[model samples]
Target: MANAFYKVPQPVNEPILNYRSGSPERKALKEALAAYKKEALDLPMYINGEWVSTDNKVAIHPPHEKKHVLAHFSKGGSDHVNAAIDAALAAQPAWERMPWQDRAAVFLKAADLISGPYRARMNAATMLGQSKNVYQAEIDCVAELADFLRFNVQYMTEIYQQQPNSSPTVWNRMEYRPLEGFVFAITPFNFTAIAGNLPAAPAMMGNVVVWKPAETQIFAAKLVMEIFHEAGLPAGVINLIYTDGPMAGDIVFSHADFAGLHFTGSTKVFQALWSMVGKNISKYRSYPRIVGETGGKDFVVAHPSADAVQVAVGLARGAFEYQGQKCSAASRAYLPESLWPAIKEKLVADLATFKMGTVEDFSNFINAVIDERSFDKISSYLAQAKKDDGVEIVAGGNCDKSEGYFVEPTVLLVKDPHYRTMEEEIFGPVLTIYVYPDAEFDTMLEQVDSTSPYALTGSIFARERSVINYVTDKLSNAAGNFYINDKPTGAVVGQQPFGGARGSGTNDKAGSVLNLYRWISPRTIKENFVTPKDYRYPFLEEA
Candidate 1:
């Protein structure tokens, strides 16, 4: 029986560890990385709290060192997808019935495990498997993942505390119930934090989940499931399966009990899933909630008043970090003709200083792209830019994939604002800059707003308050998470409730209470204090 309203531990953002040379964290991380590199793991599908293996194993290789094998994950098919869904459905009743505090405890413990003992292992996995540098891996897999877990618990409690106003004769309350069926969580490859959070969010809200992580991400994802299991997540609460996307979607989307989708991937995939759900709407037990954070041709627009150094730094970090694989990475920039020269000089200097190599080398700022496919795609863009008369290679246009998928941090100065590189998402360490007339800041803002179909993230750099205010309002609909002076990439969990509307996603604002609301169905309960003998209103008294 429920006795008290349990207050969860106050949520705080997990502090990022700087693995500087000679630091204990650096030493520990180095040891972990070496350990991971020494052995090749045989990973398995986590279903119903069991490690399920199969003969169909896919080899995993580090993007920065593709010659070496890191792990091989057992890939499942339609049968495994069906089995995962079945496990989730079977576990739904007891899992949902579990106390919210108990549910919160599970993830909270997972958060602690992530930040404490499991931190280095997680970071090492991300570095080796996904080609993230030490700092990037720490911020992503450890700090950010912990933040999502702890902060989401706080958000869930806040959601449950919301109540309706009660009348003098009636007591009214709002009950936030978990959804009728299971949730499907399709996570991306770039962020291990996202891979962990996508399924964990809905499961924390008392919903069962069938999680499908990208093949490229499964190496670290295995560690995530292990941490969840260690933290006491119940069997079948979150069934992690490896399978073909379309095959899994066919079963999940067409099922009558399909409840919702928690997705982070490309715009095309999200749209296709949405369409499939729409087509099969009649088959579902209830309206399925679709929440997605999709693709972006994110921009960084600089004003003449902006400091050249600031703009340069923003572009350097925002556009090139993690090889610009982030959906929020700044792929396009519009610089004023007045400040272009200084910005260009500083940006080129920064690019020149960046050392590109394997993630094992802490001195290297740049690493390989995720795979050969991404490498080829990005190389094609660079190739076209080199051939086109309308663009100039400003700096770093070299690509050598002889050893690994290495594409140099490239910059293109485009004559046309709507050039293919400027409008399209390159998803690599490539930034396309278009120099507009210094006097045409307003026109450039309009162009920025209209250039991309995505409204995910964008940044505007200006010193003047008037220019900042005007540009902010003008490009209000251009980005979901807009930045004034900072880069658009590192959105903190509790601080920035991240999401965007108008093709980017549903803009449910993850890291806030808004996202938790999506996984629940609320029912209002009203009990009359006094029973009326007559079934007539005051108007029936015939005054």
Candidate 2:
């Protein structure tokens, strides 16, 4: 078959709408939330295009209200993993042989579905299940997920059209092939976009996937699966399973057909998985691709010339949004002594005004952490801060888990920059600040860079061009997604391709073509146009 030259539509970042008071989006989201809350959603595992059920079903509840059950998903087992792998192997040949345009159409259509009729439902599911407010839900489920779908399609076409230069008498063609085996996608609980994108990104490039989403995120993950189903994603292209991760891992990692892993989660878990893959390397047909974005102790550093109020806003949003569950959230901050007072005032005011509870209330800026474990973990941090002499609880440090796993957005002012809280990756709404002399900006930058093993996302605020340049250069390896005069969170798809180095991840830079490359293997095809009837070369004959 001859390939035709084709170009994909340029992807644009999906816009996040303000679901403000009396707005249509607010009204619709409220309606959807109410409607979804009333119903008992039985989320099933999708294997080979079939919704499969298990005897062991786990009840999933909203973190904001622990008693309120949002959905029930089957706890899959090793048998389910085996079935999924069988299905993927059965479906791989025809699916990979299918036209590239055909594969691209599925994700593009899924993006449109997310943007149109499914927008409210998707956002509502995220808010209800994940405890994200309207704005957070809109940015995650409605915008970022759609961006992943659309941008991935564009990237697929781009990957396909990259051809090698050939001699005048020869024509060289290059083809991007899917992996020889299925990819295993392990998604985190924080972002709905990540839950969908982790699996779908590889599937868009003609690979099958065995996806295990965080048990907490199955509510919205079900909706994403439905959208992909509606978009006519072929059977076994991306199978979803809700199971004990380790059980699934045991079967998948040892299998000869395990081709790759797409992961977004904790550092410990990722490291463990990597270690497992390494130990079982000799048992596999090929080395599995390990791509992960783990934990981050990201930071925000402000110079003497920086606007304290603006810096305050940046820290508040970056450190506390979604209770700072984001991998890129700013947990450590360095502030000049001159700017701390003003920034502190605004930050304290913002924290005081932040309404903490469930996401149903539109005015509530903060919500509960994921579950009791997260609640207990954060509560322990608060408890430790109260006893620690070097740190002072400046804004808020409170936890009430009677009805929900709620932890207030807490701020810590530490005398020592190397304070435990400042250097660690606490994936919660706890921001640690260290005051430095205004003239010691260079020294402070070096300290922040060396403090954390993670190099995920961070920001620097400075009005002086020279100072900005210096900070940018000095802290280049500290963060992969670096910002100027802005917060470290909220990375837009097309504009800021997100990923980080060191312990943070493989630095694949998701939301761009770079990540898509990891899923594919290239083959070069060369055809000689000149007739060669004789076996000997001209030099051989003459010599």
Candidate 1 global lDDT: 0.94
Q: By summed lDDT, which 10 consecutive residues of candidate 1 come out lowest? A: 534-543
The stretch of ten residues in a row with the least summed lDDT in candidate 2 is 1-10
Tens digit of per-residue lDDT, candidate 1, span 129-175: 99999888988999999999999999999999989999899999999
Cα error of candidate 2 at position 440, Å: 2.0
Alpha-carbon runs more than 4 Å astray in model 1: none
Steric collisions counted per model: 0, 0
Report the lDDT of model 1 for residue 150.
98
Taken over the whole model, the C-alpha lDDT of each candidate is 0.94, 0.92
Considering every candidate listed, which one attains the maximal lDDT? Answer: 1
Provide TM-scores for the models.
0.99, 0.98
Question: Alpha-carbon error at 169 in model 1, in Å?
Answer: 2.8
Error of 1 at 379 (Å): 0.3
